[model samples]
Target chain A: MAEEITTTEEKTVDKDIAALLTSPPKRAPEPTPELTGKIVKPKIVQGAAAHYKPHVAKPEIQEKLGFPGTLVENWQEAAVAKMRELLGKYKSLQVYMDICVRCGSCTDKCQYFLSTRDPKNMPAGRAELFRQVYRKYFTTEGKIFGKLAGAVDFDLSLLAEWYSYFHQCSQCRRCSLYCPYGIDTAEISMAAREIMDSIGLGQKYTNEIIGKVHELGNNLGMNEAALRNAIEFVEEEIEEDTGVPVKLPINEEDAEVLLVTPSADFFATPHLESLVGYAKVFHQAGINWTLSTTAAEAGNFGMFVGSYYHMQKIASRIKQAIEELRPKRLVVGECGHAWRVAYAFWNTLIGPFDMLNQKYPRPQHICEFTLDLINRGALKIDKSANDEFVVTFHDSCNVARATRMGDKPGGQFDIPRELIKAVTNKYVDMEYDTIRERTFCCGGGGGLLTDELIDVRVKGAMPRMQALHNVMETHGVNFMALICAICKAQFTKIMPKYGIPMEVAGGVHQLVGRAIVLGAKE
Target chain B: MSGLTLLYTLFAYVAIAVFLVGFLARIWKYATTPSPLKIPLTPAPVNSVGVVYRMVQEVGFFKSLFYSNRIIWIGGYLMHIALLITIVKHLRFFFKTTPAALAWITSFEIYVGFIFFGALAFLFLMRLVIDRTYYLSLMQDYVLLIFLMLIAATGILTKYYVRTDIIKVKQFVMGLVQFRPEAIPGDPIFIIHFTLVLLLLIYFPFSKLMHSGGIFFSPTRNQVDDAREVRHVTPWAVKG
Candidate 1:
């Protein structure tokens, strides 16, 4: 009874302080405690994003992925065990858990933290959510010192915090660039998610998509016949727009190139437009390319969840497609993180691609293919075809900072800008700090693209939008060219919220489709 | 031998043992751990030589910290450089005759203690003043910085103010290395500094200070970007 009264008194005191801070009196001090430790900084808003948790996965989705159907009765036990398993499995997780000194170099680096002013959205702060639980259950200092050493027991509240903040991270690796130790919070986010999933607490967006890939070979759950129909629709759409006969082949044996693109290209706009671009690029270059329904998707959400098993299962479809179709060359389309998995992890996931021609990269980017044609002067580009709109490229996070293109150090940045300039007369760039390896996220990468997380998504996109706002003022930059399907989908949905047109978001290849000149056939 | 001397000696050996064995255990864990994937943050160097250069830039010059935030880079870099020099220059205590390079660097040692003291104070102030860092700082963070500052303070005082007998201090340090327990100089500041350092050493391997060894093991920094050219395979990740 005494404890209850004291708790109530403390609660009332906190309420009084909150009221005083929000609705200030003339002057009475910020309770001495609030303003004393921190100098009046508005950038440290607590609880700003604490409520913005994404929807959890339903039991059916959980069971489909071979995980437990619900949050287990022994969730805390399972979670700690999972953490131990991950610590043993991933050297990245193990090393990262030990090394961070919280120096604040990366505090301002994460966009979510920047836009939301929520300290937990900070890279180190977000990683600390997981690290707190890691300490109590894993390390000696944490075991002894407990909260003094930044350790907290694995509890429901911590799990709730993990779900909210871990999904908030786009796994962009932007903070890693600035971190003195290169402590990638994206790696930590993935590990936190894996632990959550082990306790039957999975995010609906990423897990459902992974399950869909297993069921129907794509994130969209589009089956073999439906995928074929979508390609045929693209072929018709292309003929209608270009007045040129372009063939989008499916399941074609003896085709020279196998095009495995993100499923969004077949369904989503601007994405579909880029699909048209890929078809036209192949048609004009006089190269043979085909889509394989068996491996219909280039986007691998498995990588998002940090499940090597699912990542391998999702990517092994491409291997099956190669065995069945025997395409001499492999080409990937405009999807950022998927391209990262394809470029960086494909060898490990599905290896010894001796079947494919060794003359080219095992899995080539579609940008590389189109750029090579323009360089060879085999395909003519009419730069003025896109003269109406001033364009800028949004470097997808995975491509810019996680994986490379064209074998150059920053080819991911250079190749797209180079491709855009070759095809478009008017091209501008956003602010320097928010472009290339330092580029901001499209606000919806890393499986945060679900509608439930739209509030944080819109908030997260603010830094990029603010950068975009700058380009618009100085250069009349209207179009934002993107290479990732997630970027396209994200910016299209989010541009309107920020008082810009949705159509401003598009693919690099969408411009290529506009500028390519199909010469009179020989 | 007095009980205090024997106790101090025993604790000193224990601290040294914990520091060495704990640090190596952490390093061995990092070194032998299999990185199942190539996850170099890109625009990364494609070859091993480039990776070595990247590591050099990270470790030798604090290049990433320099790029991160100028204020932190200033504080952190000074602290590290001063600490490195101070550690090397103090080798004079262990050496019967100091090496030429050690003697030459010791000439700069006058400013190192002050610089170190200033840097730790700067870091502590920064941690307190910065809203983000203040919220992020665990008690261990502040406690560790204070320990370092206290160490610097006593070392500085002994050099310029209290003036402990240099020969006795050197004899004491050398005696520990040679397995001979000698009478420690009885200055209060000196004893406080020495005790704090021993406690820090015992705490180091069990704490975030392992970042000193762990940074080199960071896959993001250490791994080369040759995933396509080289089929890098980890033991557990290989499929049947």
Candidate 2:
């Protein structure tokens, strides 16, 4: 009885703080009604429009962007040398050359191929380009009867073709599944991209994003102040919705958990709701969690850019943030590629972190977090809130099968489904060919989420759109909930184009925001 | 039965057991290993027609077969296909005894024997004569190839030259399959050859031969490249 009274008093104190933070006397004029509608359209949003527009190369900006190019002294020469070195490494290129039986099983497997309806996008042809070169360089018949075998010399024209063909690939391991010999063309592409980037021929957009991440500590140029303001803003929004002032604690000194998310959420819509979802859960659970303005983003573009150094450097910011905050656990935000890089590679680089005097705890994604709450019976959610539509999950490639076991690294997918079941009415899966490891790509993977690649992204997203359209047409799926920030942003932008006007929620966290009945008496 | 034939049968059964156990074990391990990432890294198609054209060209036209190191690609594939088809054709023996409608697909085993033995001969010659290949080929690789060639050669000789009693051969095999007592092969050479073949079978699961099986489990090739778009959470991913 005494504990109940004290809890009520504490609730009253929180309500007082919430009142002060929100409903500020003379609240700023409704964000100018123009910005509200404009926010949904990338073109209408001036900031996003300007950011997305193809960067007009300015001499000064170029000067700032310019750096001593990669280790290769010359682009073409170095590329040739690298190609020769790779070709020479294998005792017999036979394992790679003869591996492709070309059952055409992998033809429809590429996101780009499906998106563009182009044949070269097929993994078989991409490999043939290299195979031809291998033949010419190493085979006797290829030396004498090159045309018969489609073998050719590694010339400047071929090098140019390699650049064009290679960049078109996202290095997504989708084709690897259908490949009979387990040949990952993506690994080959990574090596190819690294070779190209070494010669200062890296894609401008990918390089710029990597540069931006380096400069501002995020893929977007969101600074510490903007991040803090975004967190504070989301906190207010959650308070308005729940009558509970959820703390999106930013850089709270000595917090138990350092929750890191992609900066895209602060600026984007669907993921913004996801942010609120997380805040609401922490508020209800009375968990000690804080968001760091620095190293706020979970998505790292360095892996896309083919820079090992950049990947390590980008991960270092997170490591440093964790060390400085000394959080008991680091919670990763909703970003797929970021999670893959973090989970797979980060522990190896900035690690053996004995200097921190603590074993680096494995990071938990937000989905894993909510599921834990549900499993522990710590949070209650009303299933009625989600009864309107039949939902299906689109598996993010990074989360599903990238690790050693090639399954869920954290045993996480079920939590999202449980959360969905708790809130939504009916859940259905896309046909067997779709969903799980067989699901379609959002087309904007591997740093294609930027505005500059909208056309390409939309085209690539066609397969997924078609699959989702088929599901919705057949089963009436209204909402597509995904965990990756890029998927949310990509689907939000491209799904509507294909008449699939479904809203993307960033995993189960969004449901918690609307469904978790807060302020319930013990 | 000659001492060589008995010794050969003993070694052959042991080899087959090891190969079957190892291969099955590896496959079980692979299938159970979970892969959830969908990062499609396959290069984009240049055009739709081009992709199909390439597939047809590579698989049907044997474009990949016309290698600079022609000896291995051509000889290796031919030998592999020949051996596989020959084994499948040999299903006549097992099926004929099952008390069902035994269809004689081919009565003349000689035709099947020629194709199998001929391909093996070509492969062995390529390995021996090809300068670069011979230099690079490991001892185990050569030994495995040689062992297969020898098995095929001995099987051919037992059928066409020696004309070993088919009933006796059947009885011996059936006894081995039933795990019962039976007389081993009378021909010492046949016994030696049979033993070597068994050793190859036992070694099958442990060697690079598993590549034929590991193809299904490789995360790189088998997972669709959807990581850029969909969020795949494995049923077994780490929880809080």
For this target, which candidate reaches the highest TM-score against the unseen true structure?
1
- Best-fitting candidate, measured by DockQ? 1
Error of 2 at A268 (Å): 0.8
Q: How high is each candidate's interface RMSD, in Å?
A: 0.8, 14.6
**Least lDDT summed over 10 consecutive residues: which range in candidate 1 chain A?**
A30-39
The digit string of per-residue lDDT tens for model 1 on A1-522 reads 999999998787556433322311232211101111111224789877786767678789999998887778787898888888889888999999999998999998887887677899999999999899889988998999898888897765677778889989999999899998999998999998888888888888799999999999999998888888888888887778778889999999989999999999999988998988888888988998889999899999998899999999999999999999999999999999999999999999999798999999888898988898889887878898999879998999999988888887998889889899999999998877889999989889999998877777787787788788778878999899999999999989987877889998999999999888875644
Q: After the best TM-score superposition of candidate 2, give how far the Cα of residue A222 lies from its true spot, in angstroms.
A: 1.5
* Candidate 1 C-alpha error for residue A345, in Å: 0.5
Q: What TM-score against the true fold does each predicted structure earn?
A: 0.94, 0.63
Give RMSD to native, each candidate: 6.0, 19.2
Residues A401-486 of candidate 2: C-alpha lDDT, one tens digit per residue: 45311123224455566666766678876666556655566777775665655655676676666666666777877777787888
Off by over 4 Å in 1: A1-42
- For candidate 1, the lDDT comes to 0.87
Task: State the TM-score for model 2.
Answer: 0.63
